[model samples]
Target: MPQGPNGYDLTVMHPFRGARYKDSVATNGRYWAGPLTHFAINTATYLFTYHFFANYSTEYPDGFLSEQTLKSFEGVSGERGSFKWKHGAERIPENWYRRQPGNDYGILNFALDAVGALQALPYMAVIGGNTGEPNTFTGVNIADLTGGVFNAATLLEGNNAMCFAFQAVHSAAPDILKGLLGNVVLAVSKLTDALDPILAQLGCPQMAKYDKSLLAKFPGAGAGL
Candidate 1:
């Protein structure tokens, strides 16, 4: 899901234009820009969330995460943890981020004594721009970045598939799930390929390859790694 662009630059020749014309231009710009920006941000957030979680949550011998880290994070082994639906739904008391770490979301916590010290100047300065006027910062939205139930579910499916793929690769055995996920990745990578120009322009990271054999092993074994 590649968003072509978040916004545009409109240079209107306003010397002879009426006030209504200028207002209409501004209103129309805001109207279309709002949804375009929203859609772009939403799509970027989902992709970043999925790729970040999928890559980071992976367990080692193949991925960066260690077994103990997975245990501590999920309170279960990587294999078992992958199947569990984990997200920030309020109803679930054991939602991610509730464990040993402090529940307070840092300086934003209202209960803190230094709440007054947290001045609005800095926020306004950054958000309002150097000219002391309102502006838009188009970037990752952290609040919505983790995503919701659907994201968790799909991530689990992909992660579980990755786990199975790794297992099958190690055992030199074929797994249907591994093949399915691998094919999905390959297929999706095609879209990334098509959007490479835009993605590169934005400096967005793309998942290059898992294991070289991920593509080869599922359909057949005994190929070189």
Candidate 2:
């Protein structure tokens, strides 16, 4: 059922009961980066239609959205966001965003990077040179670091996952995609593990949701984040 880093579970069911979260997310009304519209008219028409029926779109109540790049903005929870689902005890929307949004994405959560890969993933190495770019989920640009900027040492050194799972997916080989997904899950867990104490240190209980136990089931991705 699990596929892709953001818990792209294929077994996801219908509107209200089984897959209600995704359905709700479809209506969440926030514009994410990089969704392709067939044409400007099509895009405008969709937006117009959405806005026109904003109050009553059966598919989405909040509205349609795409995804965001990681490590692009500053002050972001460094915690990934989550799926709209209400599943396991740990599976909660707030908790997922507390971890890495694109990495080991909690079940049914989606944050696909532009072009479905981290062609230019965003991240930082504060201990080294301080790229000086703020990090966040949306409006991020490519991070030339272009490789793994992870591990306990990296964490202590002030390095950010930056690209999150989008990096793993892009950096992987064609045959290694599936394994890369697992790695993304591991990375999300790792980031969450790293994020928890830091948030606690900062006295932000609001950020606790991004902790490890919540996002235990990272999916296997065949596609993008």
Candidate 3:
């Protein structure tokens, strides 16, 4: 397999990789340099957004909910069912879920490049092999071309846990981000409800993708998002 029909490892980077701050921080240039730092962005994003919407709304008009109080609600929604859709391949149709927006909407699409980067690292050891097995990595590991290669030809791991967890903390991260955005929506929803008896306001309402009109409940007594 070659190109140039032509050049081998010429190392010429495309110009588009050098983009703006919000963009490049994920894909082309992201690195913790180590494990401890790999998903730092996710934790930070989760803490902040969770506080703003989840933590804030639960206690507002009264006080803030203790951090321990809210953990009781994580992923506890009662509605549950089995997913029966079976495609010949794992590919999902574009309309099936909320689509990702922007170039680096998640953690940027590193694609095969991420595997190449891992293979090149001389330190810390390689951990797995083909068929998801682990073996002693040899200097010849590159020739096998296996590590992260999903199809034995390419690696498509742009949405690793670290990447997804980071995106989940932001409103831009689709419905799951709602776990945090839910707070803000709840806050405004309650504010709208409490004020419905007398005052009419525009600022607090169904805005953006979240319908303020739909989130009319505050879970329990004396809580407002």
Candidate 4:
């Protein structure tokens, strides 16, 4: 089923048998196509997710929380819940959650490709089918195809792990920043409370208010007042 001098032979590339023939040029190429495509997709996702989280972490280390910690305060109480929503996803410019499905898919694909790549080598060895010669015009030799699959699997796993890690970090960034800001405001309020006595002795107006409403917003800000 080799092609004509100027055109591809459809019989050689038939959907059912294109990848089954040992000597056909399309065999090895088609056999490895699925894993290769998965590898490429995971690699691209890893790069994008890694850079996003890396840049974000570098730019805001103090405000970066782990996903677990972010979730801890998500629906705990009224103020914390409002804080999470108001200063977190609601205010952040980017849609971090939108990319989650892609990352999830990448992880699943990585698992499938890893298993496929591992099985491919053993399957080829057991099948005992001749991979033909090493001529460039025909197709790749068995050794080259096996090596390529191994390398692609290794890279795919590594990239998939990186993508998962970065995605977690990116997803929690907004909540972490919100918490940091809330703590800063709380600290400032406490400092103002500490200076109340000094202002009273100097006959100056006190800036710190122990009002119930304000204390409710910055809980523990009026502890000593």
Model-by-model lDDT, in order? 0.26, 0.26, 0.26, 0.30
Model 3, residue 132: what's the lDDT? 16
Q: Candidate 2, residues 103-188: lDDT per residue as tens digits?
A: 33221122221111112211211111111222212222212222233332332221122223223333332334445566755665
Q: Where is model 3 poorest over a 10-residue stretch in terms of lDDT?
A: 216-225
Report the C-alpha lDDT of model 4 over 68-186, residue by residue, as the tens digit.
33333343224433544433332222322222323333434444443343344332211111123221222122223232222323423433322222322232334335556767556
State residue 61's C-alpha deviation in candidate 1, in Å.
60
User: Model 2 scores what on Cα lDDT?
Assistant: 0.26
Q: Which residue pairs clash within candidate 3? A: 3-6, 53-183, 53-184, 57-225, 59-63, 187-225
How do the predictions measure up, each by TM-score?
Answer: 0.17, 0.15, 0.17, 0.18
Best by lDDT: 4
Model 2 misplaced regions, further than 4 Å: 1-60, 63-148, 151-162, 174-225
Q: List the candidates ranked by TM-score, beginning with the highest.
A: 4, 3, 1, 2
- State the TM-score for model 3: 0.17
Between candidates 2 and 4, the one scoring higher on TM-score is: 4
Residue 168 Cα positional deviation in candidate 3, in Å, after optimal superposition: 9.1
